[model samples]
Target: MEFKDYYKILAIDEKANASVIKASYRKLARKYHPDVSKEENAEAQFKEVGEAYAVLKDPEKRAEYDLLRAQGTYRSAGGSYQPPPDWQSSHAGNRTHSQRTDENFSDFFDSIFGAHGSDFRQAEDFQRSTNRRGRDLHYKIALFLEEAFVGCQRQIALRVSEPDQNGSIKQRDKTLNVKIPAGVTEGQHIRLTGQGELGIGGGKAGDLLLEIEFAPHPYFTVDGMNILLTLPVTCWEAALGSTVEVPTLRGKVKLKIPQAANSGNKLRIKGKGLISKGGEISGDQIVTLQVSLPKERSSEAKALYRQLAECESHFNPRQAFER
Candidate 1:
């Protein structure tokens, strides 16, 4: 539980607004997105950026975090300090000041902020008589393609901090049930009120913002509501045209392929894609046809090919390429 200075990560003051935080995060994330970055420790730096944005992007969490910092309890790990008794008990059962997992933070943070119990307790005392709004918390949720299409419920586990009589910090785990609505898109946000950081002075509790992301599927790629799939068809199937069974987010459906259909031909399934939130509109699933050739050929097959090649000598497929 080392102390994390999010302000330093974003190169901004504690007074920076949501826009500033988002701008800084985007700039940094692009520089360290792993796919394009060659810098050493880029991934670590990226994680830190995300963590900072998670707290600073929301007003409630920012306020609560600032409040804790105002108290002597919040300090860098390098600083030497100890907590007094009754600090943890005061902030018990408050979720806004929840402790991040030790795995997510650096060892330096653990050595410094590991004892969050006292900090939270001090925060409680500071707000004992004040009117404060609850803090907003951020959560990242992974969804399957089917879940994203049809909607689903999920159980999420979170770790938080609790205090002891001696003002020592201890880690605790809590589980929550979350309902994911159908047709949820990646990067879309779902808000759950009163599930965020606790408000000070008996004020209203904050909200929890869950950001949606879909797990990679072997067969499909999703872009907004559109579903893209590359379906492999046999040569005969493409040449003769046939009804093929295709898989969608919902289930399998038959697709009619017209005769003489070429490779790379696209077929659309209307209203069979993702559903839009709070709207009756649905996206279309685009299926691209790919022709696969047999790798092995028997002697009879080769003789038949030779006969066909002799009969089709008038057709030169590469005349355009030669020209």
Candidate 2:
């Protein structure tokens, strides 16, 4: 039989304490457990890990195995090992046969520590607790800004893992209609209770954490609960007061532009922005004013502009440069 290095199997140092050995076993068991792991050959790997833990967890079995390793009695001749004649475990008198037949330990394990080598009951106890809960699942829901502003219901299709009658995990199609509440910010999570992977061994099912992501919008930008919009206005409209229609989350609304409003001026419309989830607080929509000049001007319009330029000739807007 090939020599099975228990320490190498567990990926631990030879001087590892009992706690480190148990910790490594638990981590590997969870990673390779057939029920939840997506790893290839998970069942075979899990069995190997369990067999390694079984031997290392027992004090008497570990001591006997260590002595055999230290003595180098087994050699790899033609990829096979033969034990020395009259080889016997000093702790064999204290060895107790385990009733665990579920685990098919390797022939190498039986050669060193007899047929029922280590106390598999302890390993089983750890495995049972480590695999009790199902793994939590995360799903991202991409929403438009309007959908997040106002609550909406979305139907999503997912393939979830569930245990069958024979205690084997199977993938089943699941559909869920999730109600997204209003005022959800980016990176927010909406949890669905018991909607994730089914628990192992009758334990409680894991929760599905729905992460909220917003799709890019062409007309608007979001800042926390506030919404920003850029409104274009003619030079006359900015020079003189006017009421213009502007787009908001709800719909288009009229906004009054103050006289002498310059480009980059901001107008605040209260309560027109995104609402809070609690409905107790409301955000304001901020409109930035951009004065747009006509690309093609008529002769009469050019003459009027020249007349206005003559009227404001003394008003040097760049007077600060004279200092």
Candidate 3:
């Protein structure tokens, strides 16, 4: 079997401190976790990361691995992998660290640290008495801004660890219809109780926290609970105020632009952005007006533009810079 470089897999330097290693592991785990990640081959990548962390986190295991690497028993990323003599002769670690990689770990790792090796009895005995509370799960879900304005239900499948019939915790998949509440903003969390890992020794199951993120909209921008929209208008429409139809989450509404409105002019429509659960207006939608000029004009229009330019020739737009 080809050797696995735990350091390279974790994206950490060989001499990375424990804290840095842990941070890198957590970040990668979140990215590749099967429940939340839609990335290509995420499940496989997640398993690789887990195996790497399993070996690297333990100092004793790391020391043995370092020795194998130094003695040419192991390999680096994409390097030729060859075992040193007497690999299974019990000179290296003897399965001292037992964190559930027995069957899943690659043959390369198993050769260096034999499965159920010399000191396996102590680790097994220690595991018998270790009962841990269910671990809480964190995940992120994306929604359109309109969905945040109007509450929606989503069927999401969660991958969790639960107690099996054999009394051992194993990965289990569960699907839930989650109700996303209205006014849920970006980075806000929705907690689902009793939806996490199965309890040990009859302990209560932990909770699952779902974080909300908004998908990018083509014509809208978000600020807190408020929505911003840019309305493109003709130069004449901006100079001479016009009533225009503006788009909102609910529907299009009529907005009156004041005469002589310049670019970047913002008009607020109260109670038109989002609504809170208490039936209160969360925020208003702000429309920024942008005046646009036609690129081409007919002969009559060009003549009219020339006349208009002559009429306003005395007005110097660069008056601010004249100072």
Candidate 4:
């Protein structure tokens, strides 16, 4: 079986933290998700991405993969390689060794970690209740950060198996309207009780667990509850400071830029980012000051800039560089 560099597949540094790994996964998952992706071989890419994340997301699996990678020679681009025999035995011994009956995974995965990966367990946990309950179904819900803060309802459709006439299972499309609560962040799971598969005779149905993911927003980048926004300012605005109106999901809020605010300077606005239910915690909006020049420099503007340059000759911005 081919050796797969899980970290390389996810396009992350080997030293990346869990949050970084998750962010990369979410971005790639959205781009290559078979249901929405426009790229060729999206289905295959999605599975590869999923498989890679399945290993690295778990601490134990990641450690074992790292051990195998160090012991054997494997390239990031992924050439032919196999795990040393007893690779699993040598490392963590308490993990499940069962291969998934589902044929959706790769042979490379089966050769080492097998179907006991997190993806399958996340979708259908093997340790389900033995009380004749229906199997729990897993689903993913994508939302913009704005929608997450305000809460919204979504209608999703999925095909599920149900018992038909003569006690045989048949595929049927199921539509569900899920209510997402406010302040929901990425990776949060919401369970809808008894919304999963049809139970057997006189048995209760299982629950549907909706995994939350925030879609990439155009201007805002989320770090936990905090939201980052790059706010553009005129050169004078940075040098002389000015009051500017910034935008949030709620609406426009005025920001006070202090004098001498340099490009890349971050200004904090408390309680303006995102708020949790009952207002327990609020994420501040980090407005990064970005100084911008006019797109087209007119003759007057050019002359004024030259005049300013001459006037500021004594003020060398790079004075600190001189030893």
Best by TM-score: 2
Residue-by-residue lDDT tens digits, candidate 3, 199-304 = 5533567898999998999999888778899999998989889999999999999999999999999999988876667666478999998899889889999999
Put the candidates in lDDT order, highest first: 2, 4, 3, 1
What's the C-alpha lDDT at position 119 in model 2?
50
TM-score of each: 0.56, 0.60, 0.58, 0.58
lDDT of 4 by residue, 19-103 (tens): 9987676666656655445678877876787778777877876887788788765553447776665455332332355635444
Q: Tell me which residue pairs clash in candidate 4.
A: none
Give model 1's TM-score versus the native structure. Answer: 0.56
Cα lDDT for residue 194, model 4?
A: 94
* lDDT (Cα, tens digit) per residue for candidate 1, span 22-48: 767656664554434566787677667
RMSD of 4: 22.9
**Model 4, runs deviating above 4 Å:** 1-131
| Alpha-carbon RMSD of each model | 19.2, 9.4, 15.9, 22.9
For all candidates in order, the CA lDDT equals 0.69, 0.81, 0.75, 0.76
Cα error of candidate 2 at position 272, Å:
1.3
Q: What is the C-alpha lDDT profile of model 2 across 125-211, one tens digit per residue? A: 767886676678899999998999888999988888876643456799989999999888778999999998888744578998999
TM-score, prediction 2: 0.60
